[model samples]
Target: MSSKLNIFEFSNPSIRTLHISWVAFFITFLVWFSHAPMLAFIKEAFDLSSQQIKALLILNVALTIPSRIVVGMLVDRFGPRIVFSALLFTGSFLCWGFAFATSYEMLALFRFLCGFVGAGFVIGIRLVGEWFPAKQVGVAEGIYGGWGNFGSAAGAMTLPTLALLFGGDDGWRYAIALTGAIAFVFSFIFYINARNTPKGSTYFKPKRSGGLEVTSKGDLYFYLAMNIPMYIALAVLAWKLSPENLGLLSELATNTLYVVLLVLFVFQTSQIWKVNKEHLQKGVAEIEKYKFKQVAILNWSYFVTFGSELAVVSMLPLFFMDTFELSAVTAGLLASGFAFMNLVARPSGGWLSDNLGRKKTLSVLIAGLSVGYLVLSQIDGLWFIPLAVVATMCCSFFVQAGEGAVFAMVPLVKRRMTGQVAGMAGAYGNVGGVTFLTVLSFVDASTFFMVIAGCAALCFILVQFLDEPSGQMAEVMADGSVELIDVA
Candidate 1:
């Protein structure tokens, strides 16, 4: 494998796959966030209150937590090519529905559905993992993630101007609908161009479909325990929208939703047990067994890395505007710097992980991020604007780089279960966002930053327990033959 990335070498099928996969992911993000920049217009059109607006924001991320898990299963089963295209194609309608929504209810429903596109990130992780060799997988996944993730910033930068170009009360509607159209057309393009795997390589599927397969009884319990936080995050979202918070849901409805979530958790636990019981009872082959703790640590790592990214991106603009009394446009432009770092910082993180060793690179990045957030916690109205901007951008780099480093290790965890693993980790990223943002509602900016810093410190400690990937992971072929995939 080349130490340098020759991304322009399209003659290489891996390069071509990398290019197309990132574009698909980019468009998914663009479509998923198309409504964000247009929210002001939508709010005006619907005459939405502050609470209603907040509810819409909550609704946007509400479904993505579980969607990643479900999409992971689908990706592992049907492969990324079909699943990603389907998600984009189906999400197009959801985007369009939100665009032309006549009522807040319609808008809310469509936005909630649009959240499904957020899971598209998990699909590409599996796809990229399948195509790239382990030596290059980290950088490849980083490029896919870093560049593809820029779609949100792109939407923020362009969609509002696009709405202006359309010129009317409904301009925002047209702007958003256009994003859907792009996604709809690109879905076919992606389907046509993308392959499940490189020629002559097998695409491994999970032995069972309903839940992640576990090697040991302890891991089975660990997997189930890890699931609790996702449900708890959902419950927090429910509480936020309940009568006590935003009043979007009545007590009865909130309680019903809680019951429904509980029931689903029970059902999922049963599925997990059903999927792994035989394996646990009989014991997994030594060659086939991989540690679940790797996944758990990565999950927490993402919870802090990508989680803080989501949470901070949501509030940074406001934090800047409120703290410095800056113009909204100026604050927004400055805040955009945070997301823009994804382009270079993420890939750099991946490259570092590839060369510097994954665990060491991730730990260093997390430690830096903790310190970065701690610095951010000190920013106040008296701070120099230029200095604050630099501080913010510096922190932003580590936050995104940490994300790059985390995913850099994901595919190597278990090749056959890459999708499930990525799904869980990706879901935790959303969980982090929800948890941090929820904390923000109850505290000041300094406290929020400190909380994230604390989480990062804890994650840094937890990451110490992660064993670096080496040797090869064994997967069973369709004909029941075993093949070894290199991880080191």
Candidate 2:
């Protein structure tokens, strides 16, 4: 609970909890992304076409948008301990399946399934929020997020070396399978070691499940409206794979998906109304009511922050290679500075949020994010490579820190619903990624950066509406007692 505790002091249970949780998250990411660096080997082994390769890449992230939402609901109902373990355990098999696939169809299916592991990040957000007090939750969540996120970079760096070390046409399979093995072993370790909450602390649960609860009729409407984008992102992915685009999905299949999405949206709206209609009809007491607007704002903030990060990181190396006329290795190494900033920048953002006011910190970061991307939009062939890298790193720092700052306020919104809140926010991050990437496919690099900058600028305007967390959040215990959790 003390923000001042030495981070390495594992003697403290909370610190130990934070360490374990992040490691669980890290392994999930390692498994989730283990294929990225080994894609060349995979393509060679499967004799895949350029279109199939691109389809594989798109399929990789396709499931995570909905998976995060489902994982969030599950973690809220069943607790992070079991949910995280189950995700990693199942994902490990998917990893192995992808590793040893003899055909592109098998590879694509497994890779798509592996996207479920990305939801592991959301589970840890709730876990860290449970163990750490408000004074320290931001930094704890930041450390968890920042460190865990590095697993992708780690996989990218190490998987290729691992493949070569194995030395064969199937080397990539062995390398990827090793990542799955590690995830499988660690799943048991995480389940055995992690606790739902600190000793004797009540593990809060949502009063109902299926959809997020809303206090006001307007909020209910807002919650329903927000769900639309997630579905739209899925539809976009489907469209990208359809006959008109990459032709991965037939026209009939794509149309079926569209119809399915529409039906699901209607079903989900009904669920939302089912869960919240009684609460809205009776009116929520002010003490018991929390603003859905906070969740909405955080969703948009993450949409731009983490969303842009995803979009940029995907294209940055190519951007550097083309614009700077550098080799793939050098460009990739330089571009990695963007992701590498996560380690320090995210924690700094969270620490700033904890010490400074949350709204003020987010405002400054979002403003900087807008400016940073606007600067990036100007980079060109004539720009000095060092200066371009500096500009990229600057933008990355704001983008990642803004992610930290957004989640810093997530747990503060509603304690019992932290998983759902984090889930929706996390899903929006993917929505942002899908949206921005779809935009990128239609535009040039500078235009893409400008679009992201424009989105960030809009998010900056929205951040002004966010009410800072103060005093304490009230949650009811199972025994009909009120417990106040600090947010101030």
Candidate 3:
């Protein structure tokens, strides 16, 4: 630790890293989410069908599931500096391609690849963990995740105005391209300025690159079981695009995707074995290990928290317009409240986690989330607008706060594989979104919300199994000495 350090001091080395890391994360999010506010412009310009628009939304998140896992391995191996820079630069190119896309298919392809950039969130998880001490890591990570997440809201607020400033049907293209350009330039800037760790601190790597390393045979089984939802989500997306469903893809193409998914699953399963073979054959010393169950619990917790957030955000505008018979602009502005909470609620979640215990904080918030959703499900046209707004705000707090609480536990899972852990948990959040949205495709609006409430109830049960992180987790330094990283 540095002699000039005081945890209360905001200018400490750890806080500096938190500031820079979150800014980079914020930029990544702003670019990644730039499409939402401009969707009307895109739909009119491209003359896309409702199904095509849905597919495009799905495409935006399609590759993120596996991309997060791969990026996690790469970050744990090469360090965040190179990985974050490369992801931003490459994603910028994809964004540029999306902006210039002349056909729906081209736009879909580029957008899907752009999802890889979303993995940048996992990179900061590792970076923040490396810088912050255990006791404060909860608040530090909460601030990084909560504040950085505001980028989406920033994009929503600014990108449309920028497009109008250029003043034409093509203005949306230029506005979106501007985000890409910013990301590309910042990629190089971040590469030049950022260091993976403090001058003398060690950067740890995972024991293997292929999958998360587990300490126990039971955890290995649980880890394997937990991966099912991600694949299921992809398969559902494929089905949605298939000829039998939305007809966005021909039967041949849809069948091909199904085959590709199966092959990828087999390959991923093999890699999991490769990473854990030694531990499976002979377990490591108890002192050298951490349970994979913690990651599993977070995976489910995020599925409900972040997952429900994604689902609610996607549907709220439509729900408001349909339910209240409001104008499109009014519905949109009302819906924006769902996201606006990100600014305060997430930081509040972190503050709560800092003052309260992580597991306790999460349990309380998640319980509130379940009940909130249940209340939201009962709303009808008779409800006052102010009351509806209040309902949304209450539910939004638990959703965003639950998100803050989830990441509060991410860095504490495993010192060497923080990226991988965050990646998996984060990916599951998307899986939850897809699953919940798919349910919406069949159900009424109120029913859809009730379904989320049901899912939240299940997640609350899973949260109980998540152990409070304590003691020092062991990692090996480059000098062949053991280092103990505090988790409590």
Scored by CA lDDT, what does every candidate get? 0.93, 0.91, 0.86
| Top-down lDDT ranking | 1, 2, 3
Ranking of all candidate structures by their TM-score, best first: 1, 2, 3
Please estimate how well model 3 matches the true structure, expressed as its whole-model Cα lDDT. 0.86
lDDT by residue (tens digit), candidate 1, 1-488: 66677899999999999999999999989988888888889888999998999999999999999999999999999999999999999989999999999999898899899999899999999999998887888899999999999998999989999999999899999999999999999999999999999998998899899989989998999999999999999999999999999999999999999999999999999999999998888878999999999999999999999999999999999999999999999999988888999999888889899888999999999999999999999999999999999998899889888899999999998887899999999999999999999999989999999999999999999999999888999998888789998888
Candidate 3, 1-488: lDDT as tens digits: 32122435665667677777888888888878888789989999999888888888888888888888888889899999899888888879988998989998898888888888787898988888787776666667777787788888899989999999987889999999998998999899888877888788888887778999887788778888888788889999889888888888999998899899889888988898888888778868777788788898898888999999989999998898999999988988998898888877876776677667889999999999999999999888899988998899899999989988998888888878888999998999989889999999999989999999998898888889889887888887777789887776
Clashing pairs in 3: none
Per-prediction TM-score, please? 0.99, 0.99, 0.96
Stretches of candidate 3 exceeding 4 Å from the true structure? 1-11
Whole-model alpha-carbon lDDT for candidate 1: 0.93
Instruction: Tell me each candidate's RMSD, in Å, in order.
Output: 0.8, 0.9, 2.1
